[model samples]
Target chain A: MYLKVELNWNVVIPAENLDIKGLMLQKAILVRLLDDFAAKKATKDLGYLVAVTTLNKIGEGKVREHSGDVLFPVSFTCLSFKVFRGEVIEGVVHKILKHGVFMRCGPIENLYLSNQKMSDYQYQFADNPCFLSLKTGSRIEKDVTVRCIVIGVKYMEAQKEFQAVVGLEGDYLGPI
Target chain B: MQNKSGHFDAILLCFRCRHFYNLTRVFFLACDAVPFVLSLCLRKIYSRLRARLKLSFNMSAAGEEEENAADLKIGDEFLKAKCLMNCEVSVILEHKYEQLQQMSEDPMNQVSQVFEKSLQYVKRFSRYKNPDAVRQVRELLSSYQLAEFELCVLGNLCPETVEEAIAMVPSIKSRGRVHDDEAIEKLLNDMSLIKKFE
Candidate 1:
């Protein structure tokens, strides 16, 4: 589910938090830098940051002489999407495999719907495998929009994000 | 549009039994929460019930073991997409949009020039870019007690026929129709999927 989460972050600015052309630190530039740092960042608890929706609080800046960079403490409200177990998401079929298709579900790119999850669907190989259902003779192909429910989630340590295994075995969650 | 092997129906049947599976899960969670409250025998019974339910589900999965295994089972945070078309005019070089336009020419886009545009822009929902359609469908289906993925299905597929629609969607009692025909029809029309249905 998508949610608004308040996150605390430490952002760094090169060249003493101010451009050499400008005399001193600026709030607008700082906020802009902070937004760039925060957007699309994966936090420990809060899924992925979509965008900086609001800037509620800011902290004093500390400058380092050796690095000539300034570090600032900031707290902001950002839009985040956290895919939970049993959560539903919409996406398009990106890659067609021998077994199933991989849906590029927003930040969760590998949300998979295996052929096993497809009931009564048969896989045919004629240079390409199509998920064919004898009941409807329908073939779920690549780029088809599908509704899917997240059945299982396993956090990938390499990327430090959760990978969700989505199932199409539910109501109103098939090809749209 | 094809019903070659009743695969869709099999999936629907599995969905129909989802509530039973959920109930079993709840029972298991309850046992775990209050281990002292529930006896060892009851826990064993709960596990047995869950196992039985899973077995029943396996049969419904179209006899495809690998498909079920993958379904029963993405670390890219950033997307590197160059918008070939800006807000203004776009130039399609490696273009392939005729097939999508053939599906449905959505009224939401530039109606006059929709045929010339990319399907990506015409689609309301996307996992990478837009969440507007997904959010709207979620809000619409919130009243119905459906699984999270079900909303995705409804928004994505937007099935036309009653037979196809009913498989993904739960029963609607307040539609005042005998068999949810009108509701499903209205939903597809409302979602601007008349071309797809036709």
Candidate 2:
């Protein structure tokens, strides 16, 4: 069983004379963790911890200040779990290029499925878009498994484009 | 005597006014001196900061260049390997005239032409002013030829071996042969010869 959790929080800043009189005062926003819903846990289970900095103030009020949605530039060590060269993992086709197609599983960016990897599909690059075949908007909600093949990884030191090979092989592909 | 006392009092008043004026001048001078001192300190700080920032920028730029050079070196190694392999394959083909006879005349001629052109280019390009660069190029050529020989043998037996051959080739450098679209296309096609792994 997998546990999905969403945490909501509101922070209050005490009003001061400087704040009331329209003098700009720096406000330090703090992120707090409420609770975790655990489906499965071992001996030692650690809860999620987050550190945040306020980018911009969206709105202010007497009782509470309404800050705009928090934006985080998240970085991950592993984009996807390592599978065998031919094994398929379910993914949503995110983008299509002349060279390849990019797919997304969860939070990972640009898992490539090259033109050569598209098997058994009559992909017309010119007229109707191949990406439209996946029906991105609707397919995103559905769980689709894709084969994660280990193609050549091009490591460009200058641009830092780390491309990995992932594809939908044969007739076992498409939206569910 | 009474007029003399009145004259002394007038002189005393004049003296006090002059002292007051001098004090005011000194106060103004001090006020002006404060900013001058502050400005000197600020200028010194700014110069130091500017120097540090410039140094950092220079270091970062140098680092980036070094990284690019390293990447280029890797690509050069791959290219040298491919060239060497192609040379060896050509030699092998020369040894197997019977098999060559079996191939179509047009393809055989085309392959021979391409092989000869590659060899000539490699030979010409290897002759650099720098002996070290020449030596490096030669070493790369030999290794590349050996890898190509291995790939040719493998490719003849199995289709998967073609990928190894393809991987040996490096990314096309846009330098030299500007306005030569044919050459660029050939280079790109060569690089793409590697099949996407399954």
Q: lDDT of all predictions, in order shown?
A: 0.54, 0.37
Where does the lowest 10-residue lDDT sum fall in candidate 1 chain B?
Answer: B81-90
lDDT of 1 by residue, A66-165 (tens): 9978777778765445565544456677778878888865556677888888876777777665677798676777777777766776666567565777
Candidate 2 interface RMSD, angstroms, 1 decimal: 25.9
- Model 1 ranges off by over 4 Å: A19-24, A27-40, A63-69, B1-123, B126-198
Which number leads on DockQ? 1
* CA lDDT, candidate 1, residue A169: 79
Candidate 2 — which residues are off by over 4 angstroms? Answer: A1-94, A97-108, A111-176, B1-15, B31-35, B52-56, B69-198
Supply the DockQ value of model 1: 0.05
Model 2 per-residue lDDT at A98 = 62
lDDT of 2 by residue, A87-163 (tens): 22344565656666676532234567766665444444654345334444322111233434333333434542334
